[model samples]
Target: MSPSSCAVLCAAVLSPCAIAQTSSSPSVPAQVAGQLPTIEIRANQDEARADLEAEQALTPGGVSLVDGESLRQRSVVTVGDMLRYVPGLWTASGSTGDSSFISSRGSNLDATNYDGNGIKYLQDGLPVSAADGNNHNRQPNPLAASHAVVARGANALTYGASTLGGAIDFTTPTARDGAPNELLLQLGSHGQRQGSVTLGKVVGSFDGLVSAETRRFEGYRLHQKQERSSLYANGGWQLGDAVHTRFFATTIDNQQQLPGPLTRQQWLDDPRQAEAAAVAGNYRYNVDTWRLANKTVWDIDADSKLTFGLSYENQQFYHPIVYAPPFFSLLIDTEQRTLGSTVRYQRRMGSHDLLVGMNLARTTVDGGNFSYVPGGAQTLSTSVANRASSLELFVMDRWQFAPNWTAVYGAQGVSTRREVRDSNLKGDFNSINPRAGLIHQLSPSNQLFANVSRVYEAPTFYELQDQTPGAPPNTLLEAMRGTVFEVGTRGKQELGSRNRWNWDVAVYHTRLRDEILSRDNPTAPGTSLSINADRTVHAGIEALVGASFALGGSSAHRIEPMVNLTLNHFRFRGDSTYGNNVLPAAPKVAVKGEVLYRHADTGFFFGPTFDLVSSRYADFSNTYRVDSYALWGLRAGWTGKDWDVFAEARNLANKNHVSQFSVRDVASANAAILSPGEPRSLYVGARLKF
Candidate 1:
């Protein structure tokens, strides 16, 4: 099959009848062939990916399962790069190794770094975000994930997540997914290189997989060098016919140089130049993490199952920044330990399906900040010692009331507690959220759905506290709560028996109270902190469609066309400071398009891709703004049973534009708030399987 054709059916092929084979005729009366040789079967029958896809198809809201195998055919390096095809998601890259600013449905639109407050992140159903609702771009490497599932809005309640941005879960490959010994290498512009070795196999009743990787990049901008090494492994064992256990472990060491944002004039003059302030203090970031986890599933009966999990993680962070003041430069050191667990039960009763789940997590941080002086004693600025805990309980039911209609109802209760010892601040937040939806099947392959839900988001430790001068910690930072109303339709269709198409579309509106926003202060030397807004409104429309058709009446030649669009409308509601002003940093319209040609004979495919972003305001005042921009790129690749090679080129037109911007109250001559987009670059990579 052609790669373009496979892309459209990546998940649709996992229907119930596709994976299971049944025998015909009566077992009691079987015709015996001439002395059939006894065949000893010793293998693990694990169908995790298919099961996951089947589960996702039941959601009555916008959801997607991205095929990691298809993404491997491109120059994918960061989490942001992998999410380009997902509509309504914005991921803007910073430096080579810096965390990308990520948002969904207008949540945390201006958060520049480490903002996962409105979104929940999970690795195999275990939370990766800390109990304090803080998350970074360090876990679940895209290279190691076999697939990714995105549950939009209240649909994530099935996974024990209660947030406005919903949840994203990354699943690893197992022996059943054709994982085997392999080697891969990638080389690109700006002195970039990446290499990895992976091993996988199944022996008797046990299956295991492991991978080790090293990556380095000189970066497109000056002073932005990055290096990282990571190790990941997982093993599974069948304890009995109805019970299975799995274990996972991972470690990563990363270091990266920081090239701060630049002024509009500076970017136009020399986009590659690093901010002078960053170079003066030798600004940099480093992280070291170790994690271990275990999960077990029991088939309680023919119609029910039980799942449980436990995990522990330890991480250390080192960050240094240069700011103007009597304090010169600040060096921050933090150590955090987290423990988490999950329990779930699923059952099927006639035409109704039910799920009940609970999630628990706790995190503790020991950290401090110090003033750095050349050849002098280090002076202590502040100390941090805090603990955070989270608990969630959820229940959901899907009822097929009629042959062509289904209704879903779900509810979740969440409780979060934060304890700060150094600053003597404490907070406890609790809430109950509910959701309801209806699904109507128009045909065997088409469906339409609508839903209403409520979400509550608590403030993270970073948002509740201040690190800059003259801005003190706000103990009054209240949690944000909101209601969501959404409607969508998604399905597959066949044309002329040989051509097919798949589509997904959704529109939603959200009203929030006590919205948290980060506003930059041009008068200050550093970035802005967070504050509570009186009220806000967020609305957006997301759409994606792809079609595969034979070219020129030839079955051997095929063409695929794809397009995705996100339209956003976000504003504040009657606030004393800003009334009904559009939120900053989020583009009003974003679009993506692709056209590809594929040949079935040699497994070859080539394509052209483009992205367009509309102009955006710089602040709540709506005085200054960034201009709209467009980017173009090309990609080509060949895949075989055991090997694959790919080459891609980005920014073919060499457009000079601002890729990302910092939100501020006002723009001035000295306060630089722009990050330049990368110049034209090329990348080539290959993978070999044994």
Candidate 2:
């Protein structure tokens, strides 16, 4: 028989009637077996949503989880889109593309180096940002995640993140996620278009998944066009019942045109116009990166598990940020390489859970500044060579000392070194961070948590090289250190037979010393300074309330309302200069949420969304202020088991406002330093799975 005929024959042999006939007539069973060989299949499953939720419940500080499946109902072009509903997170996308200004608890709000610091970005529990605690504008594509986890401040101790903003982790999609072969297409305002493809399967002992995406946008503001392409793939192998291994590969190319910031007067006149300097210089922020990693898990008996990881990354980028006179536009081009490794062991004993881990990273950078002119003319002016490394060891224990209470404690020891070869400069830092927390069970579905922790962050190569005036780059100053106190409650409960409600609320206060800070030079057009502040304080409240009710007591229809609010109160203390001044950037109050109506049986939903932001300061001296703004939008979608479609409309009022901007010690009220938010836009997307 031909292969096709054999397949048909095999199906017929496995039919219910055939099975009964084969039992009555044994020769029929032998004939059916001739088509194929006997085999045993093994499939390893990834952690389920409930597993991740349980893990987060063990944390005694602020934490959140975002389901990627839920995000598929709307346009997700930026990190801001992925994290919009997460409390305490502040993300503002540029006029187009994934470029964004992100902060938490008033961290990394500096003007000079907005590429982001004070936060660690990770993918599948491994670092995606560089070794030196800098993001370098590298944000993992959200499309590849099964879900995302956000751990704010010292809550990220388990991940070896000691920065004020802590960590954001995106978990890769896996075969167990049951993601089918898919094709996706999107169309939006400003000549925007995107296409994506994903393939996933589980075959015998091997499980594999791969996804690729490409996007183009003409942007709302002049000279703000951007393009991106990315590819992500992973394969997992079930070596045995005791061992499992996975490998990952990722690459992304981002090409973004710079519209730059506008002066207060310029924004007032026309928020859509690009800065003259940017237009004339043809400035850009372009990056190309590729990475490979391997992770292995060993389940050695029921009570113990071990994890090992290694990774290699290569990146090249060209960015033009500073526009000088006829001499040159300050440009940076760099080739960076990094090697990282990690090992962790976990054990469960009676009432105690113990975890110990070690992580190491080494990085080398070779780059130089360019004397750039319009029309792509350039010259290599100054060269840079740098080496940096970090090593960390950590241990934690979760002890259930009583029936209703648990105590969590941990300590992390870190050693880091940074060297500038050309300048003959070097700096070394070491610190030990300790954290302790308690969790009290209010009920099976509700809990209260309290924690106090210490965090330390050393200056990166960028800050160490900015030797402007008062700050001494040679010494690199002291690392930023902070102590945080926090209390929070989270839970879900059934309001009645037809309604359910959920809530998450947290209050946190932090005292910081030797905080690294930076500002654009108000007097010098193309210069900036990086300094260490004497003292500062950050306090905030993060609250979220969500509820769902069956419309008219009918299970076929429902209404959902969600509200999230954030309050930031940051200020300086006992400083000779800028005494008691509010921190620059970030609003004092912000609110966001949506009200949606859904037909459960048909999988149709529509929602109205809103965002309200209070005014913010443009300078540390509080001389200039950015006005407050409110935005309204809508989302509608229809979902099916194998196909889905969505439409997203934003800035329906076409409000003229600033999304984010640079900062200074004191503003002249006319310095060109504001980034305009996008105007009115609409997006539509559809996906098909097979």
Highest lDDT: which candidate? Answer: 2
Task: Give the per-residue lDDT digits (tens) of candidate 1, residues 1-690.
Answer: 222332223223223213221111001101121111111122322344444544554577878777777777888787777788888787777764646666788777653554446778888888888887778535467888888888876678887777767888888777745676788899999888998999988888898999999999998999899999999999999898878899999999989888888888898899999998787766777889989999998876655678899999998987776545464667777898889999987655545566767888999989787777533555677897989998887777666666667777877778788887777878877777778988777775677889999978887776665333354654547788889898898888988867999999999999999877776644444435677788899899999999999988777788988998999998998977888898888799999888889987788999999989999887778877889999999999999999999999999999988877777765554557788887899999999989
* Each model's Cα RMSD: 8.7, 12.5
lDDT of each: 0.76, 0.80
Candidate 2 C-alpha lDDT tens digits along 1-690: 222332343234233222111010011001121121111112332336655666677789899999988777898878888888889977787644777778888888787544488888878888777777778658787777878999999998878778899899898887745666888889999879988999988988899999999999988889988899999999999898878899999999999999888998899899989998888777788999999999998877656678899988888988886676774467888998888888877665545556667778888889887787755677887797989888777766666666667777877777888887777778887887889999887776888999999988888777765454664546566789989999999999998787899999999999999787888865555546778788999899999899989988587799999998999998888766778899888899989999999898999999999999999998989999999999999999999999899999999999999999888888887787899987899999999988
Give TM per candidate. Answer: 0.91, 0.92
Q: After superposition, how far is residue 565 of candidate 2 from its true place, in Å?
A: 0.8
lDDT (Cα, 0-100) at 467 in candidate 2: 50
In candidate 1, which residue pairs clash? Answer: none
